[model samples]
Target chain A: MENDDTEYPVRYIPASKVLQAKVPFLDVSPNIALKKANNVLEEMAKDYVNWVQEDIKRLESTYQDLCEDPKSKDAITALYRVSYAMKGQGGTFGYDLVTFILNNLCRYLEEREEFNEGQLELIELHIESVRMVITHELTGKGGEMGKQVIMGLKQMINKKG
Target chain B: MSAKMLDLSNINILIIDENANMRIIVKQILRALDAHTTKEASGGAEAFTTLKTFNADIILTTWMMSPINGVEFTKMLRTSSDSPNPMVPVIMLSGHTEARYISEARDSGVTEFMAIPISPKSLYLRIAEVVLRPRQFVQTNDFFGPDRHRHDNEKYRGELRRQEDKEKQQDEMELTDAHNSLLKPD
Candidate 1:
């Protein structure tokens, strides 16, 4: 392909000095800074439990909305949005099982413009599993129960495929 | 994990996300970093409104959002006359790890990309990159954002290639050779 760079005149503006002036370069040790930051994250994790509870409720309601009217894009989007939000937060607080379950659901939703009966069922099952995870304070992989839940979800997805 | 310590005490950041939980988590982390100020917005449109007075040195936005997504918001910020600062660095936070999604975000003028469940260390490193080693902004007929070429491609001859950049690279290489020779007398 022939390159025509003349169409747009390019100019480069060096931006480092300007940004450096605003963002201070500290002498503080990284280990100490990270420790403080992690402490803050840990403090925030306390809220995550309650937050995920509300999120599960939101997921359950979204599922209900989809069930009542499977053709509604709004419900589907809401379902997807909630799942995606949960996936991003769960890992920070040791709720990796929630993230693992929802990651699959998010992918499924991403590929779908519309839902089918089995699709809705799959989504419902995911929502239920996450609800279980949250309700039981099931963090990390959720141990044996988590493994079983993940395996079951995978089997359902494979069956659909 | 990085060695550099940042004094975030003077930096003001704007965070835009549709998820409340995300906003809470990010704001908490930013505060923990001692960011001088942070203004939160639920989505891109609200972020635009907040930008009118926020004086944000950096923007952290989620890739997917309602009302206006991060890509659209970035394009407008880079081009819009009303944008408070056209050249402000934007670090896009995302859950979507698809290649296409990342490419779209980059093309739309995001300065950096981070897949979320953001840890303090990862977030700080990104902040440090933008501040300590900022890329030059490039303006043209179509795009007005950071220079997309993060490193020089010496093999390809292009109309826009700078001779100065080639010379700079050669000088650095020679300097490295000299330093290596000094370190090893053999």
Candidate 2:
């Protein structure tokens, strides 16, 4: 049995000492570990991108329904909750890119900010850009699409501010 | 009830996450668990300030943060006993599945490690585990109560909003060379 007296964040204990030792947080700076840990995070980000894409579709559909009837307080509350969940999980998963994009999306929802068509389009494009980034991170092929989307978002935010 | 879990109403829990939505989600989870009051921080520096001032009974912090990540922050906290602030129990949260992450967190004086997507049930269970078995989890601190905690969630939330807006504006305006560097090597 391993010693139970071991303190965390200092002594590393794992089944395979070799694989465990390479757990980058213990040895390397976060910048370097980002690369070492990228493989699993890339896979996780791919899965999460699919999840977020589905969520965005659902959110957009709900928003459209609410715009038609504007009285679905329960639906609105639930939408906020889902946005909050995405924000939490996105940050936790080491997908700060996803987190950044979702945070912007959530801010619009939280503030109940009425989005003009152009602003709504910008938000959608940002979400799509985040999705493209996740895809690129996963498959290393969608880099240009991701960059273009990010560039567009930059232009929009800059123009608005 | 089985073994009588720790009464959260009496315990001052500090939740630290760099994300505002995360702070809200974790607060909602605790609130669902009948926890009436939770001290929250958006980042490690803010968390430290809150801990020094409010003095929580237990701390729940996310592992990754800008400026000071959870592991480094906890290490700094464990050393704060010699400073003005005394020791406090810390629970570190992580999304990674690797056990070594937990080990590192533990070694750095983290009281417990709870995997992320921090739902009410998982957070309550983790808190119960730590509060129940202090010797195995964290060193007991007799100086924690709800009354001692400051009700500054609103203030912290406002400050966080300002910071987030500033960061977003900067990201938009500068499109700094550092942005691409943060993503991956070109």
Candidate 3:
């Protein structure tokens, strides 16, 4: 009989050893640990909120430059980077609305090889939406207002597409 | 296996993501899972450097990053001679769950795929799967990664059903020969 189990040799980390180590972080938290964890995460997310606000300001300034010169690829590139970062960070920080807004922005920017006036306007709207989401600290895909904003943006994006 | 039976305290996890907040969130989840020793890297290059110094039991990385993405990093880990640990299980985290993206990550040797907005339970389940029921590693001329097949079903007929039995036998012989050629000499 052929040895069907013949396989490559690889070092396997034993689960027993891992289970033996002490987890101090978990020990300190009481029941409702996830909520406690969320509180801590919320505190940490505040710092990122400040950073995103600053980045949004930068995006606004860059948008101004693009307005003066549509061919300012640098501004567009900068805009894309800020939006892309926000898209990745929003949901992680419990700001799913920000993630949703930036996700649309990032997808729009990614699809375009170049930015024209109409596309630039769309980008501005997306940026403003992101700014609003962060400014309000809207979490979990904003309530009714968030849905309206997202729907509005989606309509514009689809029309553009 | 239940999560209660699995212990993750001693596990050293390395999380690589371009976004700082994402790294922080993932760390919190790991800590919630009773994982004490965790490391963070902002990008793949930094992760590669960290791997050389800190031996991680498993890796959780994002799919998109500048200069070096998760797929590129996984390829290097699997194929690069200088890799610190080629066989360490890797779980790729991404907001993009498009089929193509998942397929790309899977093809790059990732052991598991996790979508963003991950809950602690989902993350723990993935960890348990990797630690408890790891897939056998496969090595071939063009591939070196975990076997994609996880279940054995006698009723499930694969693509071989399209071919005659005799042709399938011939194909199996050729595959066996190819696999043998990849093995190291004694």
Q: Candidate 1: list runs displaced more than 4 Å.
A: A1-5, B1-4, B152-186
lDDT of 3 by residue, B96-121 (tens): 67667777887898988877666554
| Model 3 lDDT tens row, A61-148 | 8778777777666766667666666676677677888777777776776676577778887888888888778877777868887888
Indicate the TM-score of model 1: 0.85
TM-score-based ranking:
1, 3, 2
* Candidate 2: segments with Cα more than 4 A from true spot: A1-161, B1-6, B81-86, B136-186
**Lowest summed-lDDT stretch of 10 residues in model 2 chain B?**
B142-151
Model 2 TM-score, 2 decimals:
0.43
lDDT of each: 0.78, 0.55, 0.70
lDDT of 1 by residue, A1-161 (tens): 12237766677776657778876655555557667878988887877778677888889898899888888889888888888889999987778888888988989887887778888888888988888888788888788888888888888887763
Location of the lowest summed lDDT over 10 successive residues in candidate 1 chain B: B170-179
Stronger candidate by DockQ (1 vs 2): 1
- Predicted model with the maximum lDDT: 1
iRMS values for every prediction: 6.6, 18.2, 12.2
Which candidate has the top score in TM-score?
1
Interface quality of candidate 3 as DockQ: 0.13
- TM-score per candidate: 0.85, 0.43, 0.74
